[model samples]
Target: MCGVDQLRVGLVGGGPWARNVHGPGLAAHPATEITAVWTRRPEVAGELAAEFGGRACDRLDDLLDDVDVVAFAVPPQVQGPLAVRAAAAGRHLICEKPLAGSVEDARAVVTAVQRAGVHSSMVLTLRHSPAVREWLAGLPSAPAGPDTVASARWLSGALLGGPYSASSWRIEHGALLDLSPHVIDLLEAAVGPVASVGWAHHDEPDLWRYGLVHEGGARSTVTMSMRLPIDPTETEFAVFGPGTPHRLAGRTADASTCYAALLDELVAAVAGTGPTPALGVERGLRLQELIEQVRATAG
Candidate 1:
C-alpha cells in the first residue's frame, strides 16, 4: 500500500553485497530513494550514486541531513553503534544480516530501534526463496510452538573460491555467525523464537553448528559454512510439514530475486503501507549470540 512518493533513504557500506543487492534494490523500489551512500571509497560510491541519482557522502554524518532511512551494509562488528547513530537521527533502518557478531551488540541495535519507535529490518532474509516464503506462508495459524524437525541443512558455497580478494571474512569469521544466520532467521520465521542450548561450541574451524529449541518445542540444528561446491540448487528448500514432505528446487543465487522481494517488503513496512513478513529483531540477535557461543567453545 506504499505510495509512489514516500521515504528518501540512504545506504552505508560499499562492499559487493551492498552494491549488488541492497543498494541496487533500494534504487529500484517505488517507496525508497537511496539519497546518499556513506562509503570510504568515494569514486565507487560516486559512480553508483550517479547511476541511482542519490548523493555520495564521505561521512555517515552527512547522510542524516536528508534521509528518512539508513541501510547499513557494513560487517557485523561495525553495525552496532552506527545503528544507534542512525536511530538517534530519527531514521528507520534496513541493515544487512548478521547484525552483529554477538548477542549483546544485536540487543543494542534492537533497543535503539525500539526506543526510537522506528522500524528496523536486517538483510539475512536475502536467501529466502519464493518457495521458502510460500511454504512458510502456509503454516497453520496455530498458537506459536517449538518446531520439531528431524533434520535440516544450512548450505552455501559462493565464497568457496573466495570473493573479490583471497582474504575472505566469510572464512575468517567461520560459518555460524556470517552465513548461518540467514537460515536461522528463515527457520525462526517458520517456527518462532529460537532459544539457546547453553554455552554452545563450534564443531569445526570452517563450520558452525548450534542447538536451538524453537517456541514450538522443536529441536533445530543450525549449520553454516563458506566451504562447498557451487550448485545451481545450492540454496534449495525442503521441509517436512506436520507429516507431509515438500521440497523446492532451483533456488539459484539470483541476487535480485529474493533480495529484491525482501527490499520491497521492508519498504512497505517502513511506509506503514502493507503487511510485513513478521520479522523479529531477537531472532537475529539470537543467531549472533549463538555464533559468539560457538566461537568461544572452539577457542
Candidate 2:
C-alpha cells in the first residue's frame, strides 16, 4: 500500500532507456515520485537522481527501505533478483519485459511476488499504447468473425547504430527475445492466450519469425530484427480474417505517455480496483516460456 497522495518509487538501473524514458516518465507522472535511485554505476545514478529529484543510493537495500514501490529499468538478468528482493520487502514492482534472463529466474520473480502479495506490473509498452489499445478494443472478443487473423512486424535498426546499440543483452538476444514480449503480449490480448507456437525461426543473423496459434483458433505471424540497416524502421500490427482488414494506423502517442499510463494501471492494480490482466510477473513468466520455445526451435 502507498501513501494517499503519491507512491514513493525507488528506481533501479541507469541505462540509456532508464535515463531517457523511465527517468522522465516517472518525473512526469503526478501520482508517483522517484524518491531514490540505485544503479551499478554510482555516477550515473547520481546524475539520474539529481535530474529526477531523488536521492542517489549506493546500496539497493537502503533504497528499498525508503520506497513504497520499486521500478526497474535494468536488463532482465538484473531485474529478476532485485525484483525478488523488493517483493520480499513487500514493495510493489514495475519491471521491464522478459522478466529475467532465464525461465527459471522469471518464475522465481513471479513466485516471490505472489507469495508477498505485492502488486507487480511488467513494462509492456503496447499494453499501454493508445493506438494499440484502440485497435484491441475494436477487436472481436472471440476471434470468430471474418478478418480475425492478425500479423505484426517489429523490424528495427537498433543494433546497426543508435542509443540502444550499446545494449549488450539486446545485441546478444536478437529481436525475438528482446522485443517479442510486447508483440506476443499484444497479440494474445487481441486474440487470446497463445495456445502453442506453430513455428519459429531465426531467419538470419538478427532476424526472426514466429507463428502462433491463439487459444481462440485465430493465428498470427510475428517477424522482428534489430540488425537491419534501415533509415527509419518498419513496424506494424494489423488483423485480417473474414471481413475488411484493420491496420494500426494514425498518430500514436509517444512512449512517455504510454509509460505514464502503465503507472496509472499499476496504481489501480495496487488499489485493487482495476483489472490485472496480463501485465504482471506472471505474464512475464508466460512470455519467457514463449521465448524459450523460440530459442530451442531456433537452435
Candidate 3:
C-alpha cells in the first residue's frame, strides 16, 4: 500500500502460529519492517529476534513503544488484556482469529480499540485467499434448500494436543469458540446469516467435540479434542454457487498461496486502493458471539 514503504511491526507471539504465520507473513510484506518481537520465553523471543535481527522485548508494553503495529499471536486467553493495552497505546493491532476466547472479551477488545481511536485488525488471513477472493466475488445468491458442510476437525489428537499445551484457556465448556468459528465464518460467507442453531458437545478432560445445525437447513459436525491419534487438518467450503457446486478449497490447504496474496491485500488496504477486505475488529467480535451461542450448548 502507498507504494509499499517500510512499516514497522512489533510481534507479540513467537510460538508456532507466530513463527509459521505472523513472522513469515510480515517479513515477506513489501511494506512491512518488523522491529521487535515479544514472547514469555526469552529463549524463543531472543532466538527469533536474532534471526530477524530485531530486538526482543519481554513485556508487550515495551514492544508497543518500539513499533508502528502490533501483531498479536499470543494464546486466546491472554489476548484481551494485551489488546486492551495495545489499543490504548494507539497502535494498530493485527490479532489472530477466534478473536478472543469469548464474545464478551472480544467486545471489550473492540471497545478498547474504538476508545483509543486506533486502527485494529483481526487476522483471518484465509479470507484474503485467491480462491476465496474470486469465489467471494462471484458468490451466487444464497441457496434455498438443505446444505451440508464438511469441515476441519482437530482436537483430542496429535493435531491440537500432542505438541501444543492443554494449559491454554481456549475452551472452558466447548471447542466451538476455538475450532467451530473458522467453519462458521466460512459458512456465513457462503450462506446468509445463521438465524438459529442447535448443537451437541462431547467434552473430555482435554477435548471438546460438537455437531452444529444452522438456519436454512445447513448442518455441520466437528470434533476438537486434545487426544487424537491423528491431526485433522482440512478446511473446505462448498456451496452450489451459480448452480455448479463452487468450492474455493479449504483452510487446511495453502496451495493457493493465500497468505502472500493476503499480505498484498493488507498493503492495498493501507493504500486506500483495491478491496483488501473491510473486516474490522467489530466483525470478528460479531462472529465470536455466534460462536459462543453454539459453544454454550456443548454438553
Query: Which candidate number has the best TM-score?
Result: 2
Error of 1 at 37 (Å): 1.4
Tens-place lDDT digits, model 2, residues 208-297: 988888877888998889898865677788888765677884335478888989888887776677876358899999999987887786
Best by lDDT: 2
Higher-ranked by lDDT: 2 or 3: 2
| Whole-structure CA lDDT of model 2 | 0.84
Please give, for residues 1-299, the per-residue lDDT of candidate 1 as tens digits.
Answer: 22467578888877777777877778787667788887778887797788775889988889877788888877777877788789878888877667765677788888887788777766665445566667767754422344445234655565555453243455566566566666666656655656655334455435555566666675555555556554432543454547565554455345667667766777677657876435545556767775565566556
lDDT by residue (1-299, candidate 3, tens digit) is 11247667888877777777778777776687779888988889998777664689977778888877788888776887788888888777777777776678888999997898666666665566665767766765543346444333454443345444453555353344555655566666666566655665554554554554556565555555544454454344566523566665434336226556655655566556755345667777877887676656753
For residue 23, model 3's alpha carbon misses the true position, in angstroms, by 1.2
- TM-score on alpha carbons, each prediction: 0.83, 0.94, 0.80
- State residue 167's C-alpha deviation in candidate 1, in Å: 6.3
